[model samples]
Every structure is written in structure tokens, then in C-alpha cells.
Target: MQHDIAYDTAAGSQSITRAIGRVISPIAFLPADAAEFFTPVNTNKNWLSGEGKRLFDLAIALPLLIVLAPLLAAIALAVRLETKGPALFRQTRSGMCGRPFKIFKFRTMTVQEDGASVVQAREADPRVTRLGAFLRRYSLDELPQLLNVILGDMSLVGPRPHAMAHDDFYQSRISEYRHRFAAKPGMTGWAQVNGLRGPTPALEQMTSRVSHDVFYVRRASFSFDLKVLLSTPIEIIRPRNAV
Candidate 1:
């Protein structure tokens, strides 16, 4: 049950033609919205569509590291002075093709801990510090992920990466959740910009996020990535339904 659809773009255009090849597993039999949409991918041996995305990610991320160096350094210093723990937080996150990679972020919490399971932080959570609150509010906490993008563990735009525990928890609850991994996880994404950011308290919220994630997969392109990037600042400035 695999198919590939390629959308033709203008000549010399740098748009991205998104595709997905479903890899069925016993775990993928969980329930999800019947209204979900998926654009199949051509699994033919001759296809070479992935190179465009990889090239684009590398090009964008390398320049961003240089461009944002000052801001990143300032944020790192701020987190260090405001917290007693390390400045950068690295944690394993599920990424493209269900592979694992360590994601980087500025530590916004007083204490950092890792376990078999992870929990979404809610508003007024005691673990969050005053500076952490500001960082989370404006997404300054995510600055370190620019390095993740540079490292090819993430992209400038796509679905936000989730904790391994959260991914496992939601896989049983939302069938389409795994589809998000069809592409690289992002620093910001359609879900975050369209009001899916922060703590997700219910299955519906997760469903909404997955919906946008899949949508971005189906309609992804360089221009679309730019659109998401442009919208992210607004999302942070006036965060709605965020934790």
C-alpha cells in the first residue's frame, strides 16, 4: 500500500516536493482520525527526491549558525547566569525514519533529568525558572536547536521533535503520529505556528498537531518552510493555548 506523488514545480524553482512511504508495522494499527490526509511516496529504486531536502537543510543551517552566533551566545550566557545547571540541554529525541538523535536546547528548567518516560510541562510547573518562563514564552529556549539543524538532526521548519516517551505514548493514542517522522523534525513547524505549541493535555490537542504535521509533509517546500519560519515569531509573541 505504498504510492508516490510528485508535484511539479516551476523551472529553476527551489521548492520541495514532499513524499511519504508508509512503513506498516504492528504498532501502526492504532486508532486515528478518519479525516486524515496522506500523500504517498514513490518507493521506486530510481527515485532521488531526498537529496533536495538534505541539501536545503545543510545550506540553511550552516548560514544560520553564523548569522545567529551572537544571539545564540547571549542566550547561552543568560541561561547560565539565571540557572545553576548547564546552559545547553541535550536529550535524545525521535527523528526522521524513527531514528534517535540528541536535540539541543537552552536549559529553561532548574533541574534536568532523563528517564524512560518524559512529561509535558504545564503552566505554573515548579520546574520552570523565571528566566525559563521568559525563554519558553518567546521560544528562546529552543535557540540551541539551531545547532541541531546544523548537525542534520533537524530542519529549520517541519514538525517539532518530541521526546521518545511522548512519541511512544502518543503512537498508541494517535495513528498518524508516526507519519510526522516521514521528514526531519523541525525547530518550528506548522503545528507550532497554528496554535499547537506548548503542553498538550489531551488527545485532541495531539491530534491537531499531528494533522498539521502531516499536512506540512504533504505540502512541504522551500517556500513553505519560509512561511513557517516567518510565522513562528508571531506565534511566540502572542502564544495561544501554550503551556
Candidate 2:
């Protein structure tokens, strides 16, 4: 079964509707409290929601988007000149409560795969274009996700959204995996700041990332989100595990 729900965007004047498929029932494994967070009736009353996380997301994202407009345009032009596809890449990513949302990013690969058998990118994957390599290296490709942050499909600080394929694969491997979706996805997350960014080619690596994500869900707060935000620039400038 599938259902469509309207989520508020940063503007708050308009909303975008997304269809969430029932490929994976998050309620089956999510904690009762966590599961309730996604319910329509409980959506606007959660810890993060009630504590002004959405306001914070807009406060930061809106300005960043405006200030970075020129740079974003430059990058978009570069991507277009360097590649033959759209400047932005869109893929379905599992959001809070296992709902799927279309995530936007700067196209960084020759092939855009978003299916059950999507392939994870390796360090020197040939599918990554020359310019794409640089973009991925500095995490420039992820800048477009600020829109997702503004779109209410994500937050400024929360668990990172994995591809639907990765979500399906990992949920089966880790019993508590779905619990990470208790909070909305983020542009930069606890796992990313804690050196868990980039491709998780191994189950162990992914498990470690999931651990941090779940921890953030359990310990999410305004101050903690600020800490993650402050630490993010450092991580971006001096990327560790990022590919």
C-alpha cells in the first residue's frame, strides 16, 4: 500500500506531497515513541518539531541558499559543462519514519542508479567524472540538499538519508536500523561529522554509522544540533572518511 502526505516547506506557505510506499514497514521495528513521531497527528509535536528545529532549519538554510546563490550557479554551470546530464541529481531516499522523499544533489556520477540493485561508489570509481571527483571530495555535491533541509523533508542535523536500496539492505542486516528514521534526514549528520561519511562498502562501516545515527535520535536536542552544525565546517574543510 502507498499513501501521500503533504510536508511543509521552509516557506511554510506551500507544501510538497510525496508518496510513501510500503516496501518496508518502519512500525514493525521502530520503538513505540519513535513510531509515533511519524504519525500525521504527532508530526508537529515531536521533540525536534516542538523545540524549533524546523525554524532553525529555515533560519540557516534560507540564508545559506541566498548567500550561496552565485556559487551554486557557478557549480551548476560547471556540472553541466563537465557532464551530459542535468546539473542536479534526484533520487528517492528514505526519510523519517521510513517515508521516501526525493533528495537533490549536484550530479556527480556518469550513471544515476536508483533501484533495488544500486551500486555503492568506491574511492576511485570510474563512474565518477573528473569534475565529479573534485565535487565529491569536498562534499560540494551535497550542497543542493540544503533545499531538502528547507523543504521539510530533512533537517539541518539528523540522520543522513541513505538510498532506498541501501535502506532495504541495511534494515535486514541491523535490527535497529529503522530506528534512525525517528528524526528527519539531514544535510550533515552526527555520523557524517563523526567521520562516518562516504561510501560504506562494508557492513561493519555501515553498522558504525548506524550506531551514531541511532544515538543522535535518542539524544537529539537543540544544543546537540548546534554542536553538530559547528563541527560540520571543520569536517568539510578537513574531510576524513569522506570519499
Q: Best candidate, TM-score-wise?
A: 2
Give the per-residue lDDT of model 2 (tens digit) for 72-153: 9999999999879999999998777666789999999999998788898888899999988888888899899999988888
How many residue pairs clash in model 2? Answer: 0
Candidate that would win on lDDT = 2
Task: Score residue 51 of candidate 2 by CA lDDT.
Answer: 43
Assess candidate 1 and give its lDDT. Answer: 0.72
Kindly give the stretch of ten consecutive residues in candidate 2 with the minimal lDDT sum: 14-23
TM-scores for all candidates: the values are: 0.79, 0.83
Off by over 4 Å in 2: 1-24, 27-34, 37-45
Candidate 2, residue 161: lDDT: 88
Question: Per-residue lDDT tens digits of candidate 1, residues 1-243?
Answer: 122223233421323212122332122332222112123322321111256666777787788778889988898888888868788988888776666789988898876665576767898989988888888888878877877877777878878988877877887788777667666789989999998888988899889999899888767776787788889888888977654
What is the Cα-based TM-score of model 1? 0.79
